[model samples]
Target: MAHAAPRSGRLTPGKRDRKPDTDGSPRVSTDVFSERTHLVVRWVLPVLAGLVVGYWAAANRRSGGPVTGWNLLFGFTTALAFMVLCVAVRVAASRMKRELHALTWAVFLGGTFGFVYAQTDKTALRSAVMAAAVGAVVFAVLFYRYYTHEDAEGHRVP
Candidate 1:
């Protein structure tokens, strides 16, 4: 009987001896944990920063005035304007990311509390606390999604 042929090195998965492609080698996917770390670094920090600064600014501006009902309306309306302006800019740039929308939403929502501070000044601290709490919760959700999400591009309709 004829002897069986030896397997070629090229057939080996890791030890392939083929010439490298001209463009580039195939990208080796890293482990899941490593990729998640990368996502956290890329997506988490800026989110926290936006929340902190946005909440602090509005809270810091209050100076202990009364919060009349009109003040509440005005505060929310102003924050709404700020949000609309931000959305327009973000939309124009065409750089709108999921997190960017979240950040803006959090800011506009949180900024309403700041507006309240500007008007009534009473419970400025409470508004700040509430905004911070909300911002924290929002980021927590984003962070969880970042680490646990299957796709890197985000917003996969589950």
Candidate 2:
């Protein structure tokens, strides 16, 4: 058999040509900003969301009343509480097993939703019942996802 000339000016196949760095320093990834961007998105997006939720809750509580210092205080307090809970849940869930992680999120989602719903002048018993129902639904959905995505040892499958 006769050999043919290598294509694309490469003597060897499957080898990539790399350019030397102009500054003589080690090459850095082009995606260096991705990690920082992810960090900002992970925290900042949630904080923004918490703030929106807090505003909604405060508005609901105000019930068309004029904005007052107390109302602003309540909104800020609620926003702080929501942001704290979001961070806590994220950290705790990451460290927990699949079941516990799902449960943690379910509880958080249900409780937050219920609390916000309750601000709409709903009765305490109604809010509790709604929370329970929401919790159950969230638990079922999260448990299903976790079960499908994790193995028997609770390790995630790629």
Model 2 lDDT, residue 118, Cα: 90
Candidate 2 lDDT over 1-158, as tens digits, reads: 89985333333323332543565543333332455676898899779978998898899899999999998888888889999999989988977778898899989988988898898889989998998899989999998998998876677653
| Residue-level lDDT tens digits of model 1 in 65-121 | 565565455445554555555546445423435566456555654654445444444
Per-candidate local distance difference test: 0.50, 0.81
TM-score for candidate 2, please give it. Answer: 0.73
RMSD of each: 15.4, 10.4
Model 1 CA RMSD to the hidden true structure, in angstroms: 15.4
Best by lDDT: 2
Off by over 4 Å in 2: 1-33
